[model samples]
Target: MSQETASWVRDVLAGRAEPVEPRPAATVMLVREGADPGGLEVYLLRRVSSMPFAPGAHVFPGGSVDRRDIDHEVRWAGPAPAEWARRLGAAEPLARALVCAAVRETFEESGVLLAGASADEVVSDTRGADWEADRTALIDHSLSFAEFLDRRDLVLRSDLLRPWSQWITPLAEVRRYDTRFFAAVLPEGQQTRDVGGEADHVAWMRPAEAIEGWRSGAMAMLPPTVSSLKDLAAYATLPGVMAARRTIVPIQPELREVDGEVRLVVPEGVDYPL
Candidate 1:
């Protein structure tokens, strides 16, 4: 935590500061393999130490939804914006943006595209000079998502995504994000490249193994990551994990004092040692 953030947390816990507005954001957990505990793997990126939020913390690929993502011109497939809006608890436009951001950010950060020529297919290979150009443009915000998709004649594969959870940053933090989490099976033959910029390192980690790293103080994770890993640890396979219905809940943690120590408290029933 930053020094200012630590001070803000103290103040919030002391009831001396007001919470800030949380920005809408999206993130995805990409998994591959089957039912075996050892077989299940998730991609994680360690945000660069220079990042203002979650510096040096291991996280999935995601960011705040770009306003342009709501553009009606974006080539879209799968659920219509109205149905998606109802499902995500947002206006039609924002719901569209959230879904778009989920796919776009995944491609931007990890070099994997959750899009294809049609609803039934996924782009098997994202490696090429042309694809690299679009990726760079997307990162720089030089190209709008709709235009990018239009140029390639690709459709966003919203069906490939499964809603997982929603988490909000604690009031104590200077930067807050209301993030919607989604899960997807890493498309076969579409591998993640380092594509370093915001991240210093990347790896494939099992939920239980990742928790062990945190237990030994070898890696850092935010509360949502910690809790999500625990929830995921119970599942044996992607199909089982995705098929089970969940009542989507909004989890916004807060600062609390316990036993003379001040700590950020995530909601109850989150089983993490951290």
Candidate 2:
């Protein structure tokens, strides 16, 4: 890491600088379906080593919520934002905002837009030029996600996102995310590209294959991503995979170092979905 980047990370770690608080972040696990049934894949991004957080780890496209994600003017579908908030044990208003942030971050990171007609109509012309700029502003606190959406008369397609799993970073980590994982089938005519500036590379791989690669030292994965991939390997089709989302449970693993190797301990007797 560069000296400047290392210094920033050290400040966050030493409490001299506060990394943003652990807020609701969203990750989209895109799966493709096929007749032969063996080609299913999920999108993965290898974050740049210079990143202060999770450098060099292959991870899903995601980031923290921004204040702009809460505009009531933004359109949405599926369960109400209030309901999602209740599920997450957060305030109703903030829950809605986080949902918007998740969708926006996924698009900004992967170049896969999830919003439909209504949301598109507003910024249909400017989306190409302004989307990334707006996203950058939100990340830097210069603008809000919802405000940016409203400026273009767009609405978030919350219906397209299905909650899969929830995980909180161990308290020991200086930077954390109270992340919610969602699954979506790769949309028709839309493809994922390596638009995430923070990522060094991107690829589509089967969950099992990714696990094998990580085991063989060809890939490096953070614990949460590894766990999610393991959970995904159980389903064969998009519909089947999404059906599993109905059983949502929060997983907060206790960090443990056993036999000189770090591991996350899921509580005994409690059935873990992943």
For lDDT, the strongest prediction is 1
lDDT of 1 by residue, 1-274 (tens): 4467677778876779887898999999888874565457788999999998888999999999999989888878888889777777778888899999999999999999999999888999999899999999999999999989999999999988888888888877778899988888899899999999999999988888998998888999988887878777787787877685665678888777677556777778656565
Please report the candidate that would top TM-score against the real structure: 1
TM-score of 2: 0.78
For model 1, what is the error of residue 208's alpha carbon versus the real structure, in angstroms, after optimal superposition? 1.3
lDDT per residue (tens digit) for residues 127-198 in model 2 = 355666775675566766556666755667776677777778754345678888878777677767667579
Off by over 4 Å in 1: 12-16, 34-38, 257-261, 271-274
Cα deviation in Å at residue 1, candidate 2?
14
Off by over 4 Å in 2: 1-21, 34-39, 86-89, 119-143, 257-266, 269-274
Task: Give TM-scores for every candidate, taking all chains together and pairing residue i with residue i.
Answer: 0.93, 0.78
Q: Considering summed lDDT, which 10 consecutive residues are worst modelled in model 2?
A: 119-128
TM-score of decoy 1: 0.93
